[model samples]
Target: MCPRSFTSTSELLSPEPALVEPNAGNSHSLRANRLLQHAIPPPMLPVVDLDPEQVRVLGCLVEKQLTTPQQYPLTLNALVSACNQSSNRDPVVSFSEEAVERAVTGAKARGLARFVHPSHGRSALRYRHELAEVLGLDERQLALLGVLMLRGPQTPGELRSRTERMARLDGLGEVEAELSALAGREEPLVRRLPRSPGQKEDRYAHCLGSAIRHVEDSAPDEVRQRDVPSQSPVPAPSSPAPGAWSEELAELRHEVARLRRDLDELRSQLGA
Candidate 1:
């Protein structure tokens, strides 16, 4: 559906049903959207069945909400920017405005998005995701989902690192535990993908739908935290070792001690 481009933010917020007046130059076919206004939202759609575009649109909304709440409920133009961003996305895309709007419409039909009227005196309409509410997901799950949907499959180690700014999955173990919890759900939100060719670690793909097309990795499949926009697997031998962790902590402690000594010397100089 190309989202019969029309203006009807009022329909979404109005208390009572009203005839949807299509925009000038549009047709009555757009009137059907009125049903979505008063309609009991459709049942939660399975993330696995969503099309790649739908997944991307929904994920962008969730990501923006979590990462930049001040800019939540993104306008169509802003949303288009997010969908086309090069970073933090797998096999980056440049979806056209029409394509993104259509995807947003598909997501709304699935009860995963909402249309919001212009706010703060802004004239253009804005939209928001109902992803968390529809999926009944908590903050942690939402964070993971947003990343998975935006970036495609990832390993537990990757998930833990990338989600640092969003959730509290302390380490690989916690990431695994949380993944298990999500997988255990009645409609599993995630699944372990069969190991990619030569991949030492099995990656986890989200149920929000598979990538539009399989994207083969160019780099040798090493199970470790990568510099990519998404997931991090436990590092291989070349990756930092556990002892390195202690050494880093030790360095931090030494820095603190140095600062303390410096403070004491300054205090002595001041005759305190």
Candidate 2:
């Protein structure tokens, strides 16, 4: 939820009751928290579908936790800044603290994130993602999801280089195998996109959410709005270049063909 930030270190010693602490000692709270932290049992792990902003918010938490542990439990200001950071982000954003907070609230509900009180004596609220436990992801999967959350979609080669520290994903084949596992899960964690015209490899994206947008160079006046995170209405689709209709069309055709093949396989299995 929208966690609080403290201005004085003195407040840490005698803090008010935490409205949303995940690790309360009480058995009931602990049990409830456990349920939320882990996916509902087998045969029904609900797909962690989320909005674009929630995706970004979760991604930011994971990234900061690994890359900037010193600043792991981010303050509201820091969280906002991380979410809006230009580097390693797709469809860059200018989200407000309120917007980020809203996304945090939504993320918490989905059991993919958590809000925390001050850490190491600081008297401020902080947030983190519980994706590793909830999704049963290894370090490799966590790294892959983090990159996709921050950067939208990317090829296996790109992921291999970016996920160096989070996991041992140095080879393209290694990355692809991991992606295939994620995509093949009963509740698929990721999905593969059709190849773009100029791109040699298909980009993979987290099915949880996306900030895709359609841009037109010839028609500057046409401002189309796509869906964003729960907090902010403005989406993060990196504005595509003009005259890319051909690419879009080709992608659609490829997708249709792929679906057809899958359908044929299903039919064969059914023996109809």
Candidate 3:
């Protein structure tokens, strides 16, 4: 036998909406609603769900903004460092070079960054993600945008140097070429900045948009602090210890060696 139970319709029904008097002074509920209205949710990139590393990469970018909002639009290297430095030091959270590159490429493909060529002709690149809407940009172009955003404006040569340190390229010619391409585009991705004193070089800036405002509002105070202009690209990944290439190369070599051994054994067995 089961015991009888009583139920109330009032319990099942939705609760009544809170009544607001004519002039409620700074109510908690009202402030919460205001915050919700202004809050910008994180990007919904596909890679976030499929690739954990990619998610970490995105987290790194967010962390950089939180740490240095003013210094916003972190260079790629800076983003990588932030991820490595995060308090969550689980093995799953580490940022490998392949992971970083794959994440960045995936993000860029999804229109998350504006890349610029390396400043000094290195393969390294710079990028800016000020706008929430990701925009496809190669390394060179991203660097160019970063330089312009931080420094206000500069000529091609100056931008070339700014992006080159990380670009890992050999010359400024590539930067020049990219600038030319941007200029020729029907709807240019970047626009030339107004000339400045003794500024012989041409400068450029990202197009202003509502997205920028959203990012600015959402970003933390520290990020806003370090975001100022500087003489050069900031130093490489300080925390992660910039030797990802060697580790990856070693892994590849080990795989190759294993494959060779397997092939040799298979050949001997066939002969037998």
1-272 per-residue lDDT for model 1 (tens digits):
11222123333333433556678767564756556554744333253457888888888888888788988889999999999999889859899999999999877766668889876788988999876765667788888988888888888777877888777877788788778888887667887765665567768778765443233343234423343357578766777789999999999999999999999999999999
Order by TM-score, highest first: 2, 1, 3
Work out how many backbone clashes candidate 2 has: 2
lDDT winner between candidates 1 and 3:
1
- Model 1: residues with Cα > 4 Å off, grouped in runs: 1-48, 210-272
Residues 81-191, candidate 3: write the lDDT tens digits: 755763432233457666677776765554444465666545667655422333334555555654444343357776666655435435667777877775555445455
Better of 1 and 2 by TM-score: 2
Better of 2 and 3 by lDDT: 2
For model 3, where is the 10-residue window of minimal lDDT? 1-10
What is the C-alpha lDDT profile of model 2 across 1-272, one tens digit per residue? Answer: 22232222232223444343645567887777666645433323444557778888889998888778888878888899999989888879999989899999887766667889875688889898877766777879889989988887789989988888677875898899999999898767787875554579977888775233211222223222222224656777887776587799889999999999999999999996
Per-model TM values vs. the true structure: 0.60, 0.62, 0.30
After the best TM-score superposition of candidate 1, give how far the Cα of residue 195 lies from its true spot, in angstroms.
2.5
Candidate 2 regions with alpha-carbon error over 4 angstroms: 1-43, 210-272
